[model samples]
Target: MKHKSLAIPYVGWMALFVVAPLILVVVYAFTTREGGFTLDNFSNMVQYAGVFGRSFLLAFLATLVCILLGYPLALLLAREQSRLRGMAMLLIMLPMWMNFLLRTYSWVFLLERNGFFNTLLETVGLPKLDIIGTPAAVVLGMVYNFLPFMVLPIFSVIEKIDPRVIEAAQDLGANSAQVFRRVIFPLSLPGVLSGVTMVFIPSVSTFVISRLLGGGMNLLLGDLIEMQFLGSAYNPHLGSAISLVMMVIVLVSMGLMNRFGEGEGEAVLL
Candidate 1:
């Protein structure tokens, strides 16, 4: 009874904040400004297919880049016995301590035409980069901001693996590569799945990164949604519809990832 009473505040908070907002969003999504029920909001979504495609494509690219960069770093960190590992992790997390907008705004200064990156390249007698206001820039921003989310989960899972299990594999004459491929990698699927989810969701729905880095040329789904609610459009109904669709798609994607993870686990066991 004590536990139940203690849980009541949290439950009430969820009901008031989460559930209530979701319900309101659903109601708004399915109705017109005057409260007439309509499906036009969903029907109108077909016109924004390009935005949806571009958002998902950029997000996928960002997630892939994060995986490539973060996995190796995480593997190294997990295996490190020196104090340098702590320092490295701190460095990785340092940028995250600052405001998210501030971090992204700093990239704008670095990636712009006359920005620090190009100026440095010019000083070195190399051709200046013109990647800002492009999809590439957006992907770079996503990777920079979200790479930690990928690294931490994988590192946590890998660090927790039983040392004896690895020793047993070695005792069976397994080479380092064989142990990693057959044992460590399979066991790390949960972390990979978690990392992928963490990176992908935020990347897909990001507006600030796209806005600042893409310089308003590349409109993503998040940009569209934001425009509807807060920009000149002023259409919360349409925004809610878009949000609902995005939520559904995200849920489906997460479900598929979970299934894939389960299958991978089973296959490794077999």
Candidate 2:
């Protein structure tokens, strides 16, 4: 009874904040300024379909890059001794201690035409690379900001894996590659799925990173939605519609990832 009573505040909080806001968004998404029900907001999304496509593509690329880069790093960290492992995890998490916006804005200084890397190349008499205000910059920003999300989850999962299991696989004639391919990789699927969900959801809906890194040249669905509500367009209804769609897409993607992860987990158990 005490535990059940303690849940009352949390339930009230969710109802007041999360549920209420979602309900408001849904209401606004399906209504006009004149308070009449309509489907025009969804119909208008067709014109911005390209933006949505690009957003998802960039997000997918970022998630893939994170997996490729972070998995190896996570494996290395997970293999380290306790003290060394703690230090490595600290280094991975250090960047996150700073404000998220500030961390992202730092990339602006690094990737801009006259930024640090370009200046270094100039001093070295090498041709300066132009990546700012491009899709590449957006992907870079996403990866840089979100890589830790991938690394941490994978590292946690890998660290929890029983060492006896690996030893047993090796005793059964499994080589390092076979052990990883047949055991470690399969066991880490949950972490990979979690990392993907963490990175992809934010990347797909990010406006600040795209705007700051891409210099407004690469507009995403987030940018489009922001424009409707806060930019010169000022169409809250349309913004709500886009937000609702984004929410649905994220929910569906997460469901797919969960299902896929479960199937892989079951296969590995078998």
Candidate 3:
């Protein structure tokens, strides 16, 4: 009875801090100016359908890039001895402890018109390419920020995998590629799914990275939501509607991953 009594206040605190804001957003999504509940906000989301697709595409591209870049990096680090592996992991994690906004702004300094990349090209007598104000820049920023997400998950899985499994395959006359294809790759699927989940959600909602890297009028759903809340529009309901849609998309992806991951299709992505 005492234990249950002690838990009551903590439950109340969770309700106040966590559940309350979610309830408010749900209320905003359903509420209408007429003081009645309606799906008008959701209907407005359908009216702006193209924006949703653009956001989804940008996020997909960013996730793909992170997987491509981070998987090999994780593998390389995992191949090292324990001390070196610890150092490499620290190098990846150290940047995350810094302010995210500061890191985003640093990209602005690195990719702006007169920034280091452009200046380097000029110095090399090569044509200066414009990265800022482009979707490519958005992908670069997203990959840079989210690469750690992919690396860490895969690294954890790799570390747990017994090296003897690979050795056994090799002893049985399986070559490097064959051993990896039959054993290592299958074992690493959980890590890949975890990495995908980590990268996808953040890439979709991250606003500052896209804004700083993708200067000018390149649109992203997160920026649109921010504009709705803070700019002249000031429509909380619309922002909530977009937020709900993004949440649904992410949830659906997770559902699909789970179904495929544990099923016969496990051989494919797992």
Candidate 4:
């Protein structure tokens, strides 16, 4: 009874903040401005298919890049001594301590035409690169902000792997490559799933990064949703419908990833 009582506040909090908002969003999504039920809001989504496609594509690329970069770093960090690992983690987390808006805004100055990056290149007698206002810039911003999310999960998982398991694999005449391929990689799937979910969802839904770095040229689903509610679009019903669709897609993607992780774990056991 005490434990149940202790959970009352948390349950109430979730019900008020999370459940209530979701219910409101659903109501708004399925109704017109005059409070009449309608499916036209969802039907209107066809016009913004490009926005959805671009958001998913850029997010996929960013997630892929994070995996390529973060996995190796995580592996290295997991093998390092505690002292070095602590310092490395501090450096990795240092940028996160600052305001997120400020961190993202700082990149605008760095990537703008004739900004720090191009000026540095010019000084080095290299051709100036046009990165800002482009998809590349948006992707770069996503990777920079979300790479830590990818690294930390995998590192935590790899660090927790029992050393004795690796030793047993070696004793069975497994080479370093074989052990990693058969043992380490399979065990780390959960972390990779976690990292992918963390990075992909935010990357797909990020308006600030796309707005600031993309210079208004690269519109994502988040930007579109924002425009609907706050910009000239001014349609909360449409925004809610878009949000609902995006939420459904994200849930489906997460479900597929979870299934894949479970299948991989089973394969390893077999």
Q: lDDT score of model 1?
A: 0.91
Question: Per-residue CA lDDT of candidate 2, range 19-54, in tens?
Answer: 999999999999999999999999988988889899
| Stretches of candidate 3 exceeding 4 Å from the true structure | 1-13, 263-270
Task: Please list the residue runs of candidate 2 whose C-alpha ends up more than 4 Å from where it truly belongs after superposition.
Answer: 263-270
* lDDT for each residue of candidate 4 in 1-270, tens digit (9 for 90 to 100): 657888989999999999999999999999999999999999989999999999999999999999999999999999897799999999999999998899999999998888998999999999998989999999999999999999998999899999999999999999999999999988888788888888999999999999999999999999999999888789999999999999999888877777878765332211
Instruction: Estimate, for each residue in 1-270, the C-alpha lDDT of model 1 and write its tens digit.
Output: 657788989999999999999999999999999999999999989998899899989999999999999988988999897999999999999999999999999999999999999999999999999999999999999999999999998899899989899999999999999999998888888888888888999999999999999999999989999999888789999999999999999888787778878765332211
Measured with C-alpha atoms, the lDDT of residue 102 in candidate 4 is 96
Error of 3 at 81 (Å): 1.4
Each candidate's lDDT (Cα)? 0.91, 0.90, 0.81, 0.92
Cα-based TM-score, every candidate: 0.96, 0.95, 0.90, 0.96
Q: Model 3 over residues 114-195: C-alpha lDDT tens digits?
A: 9998999999999987888788988888888888989998887877889999889999999988987898877887888888
Name model 1 segments beyond 4 Å from true.
Answer: 263-270
- Candidate with the larger TM-score of 1 and 2: 1
For every model shown, the clashing-pair count is: 0, 0, 1, 0
Which candidate, 2 or 3, would have the higher lDDT against the true structure? 2
Evaluated at residue 244, the lDDT of candidate 1 is 96
What is the Cα-based lDDT of residue 171 in candidate 3? Answer: 94
Give candidate 3's whole-model lDDT. Answer: 0.81
Error at 238, model 2, angstroms: 0.1
**What's the TM for model 2?**
0.95
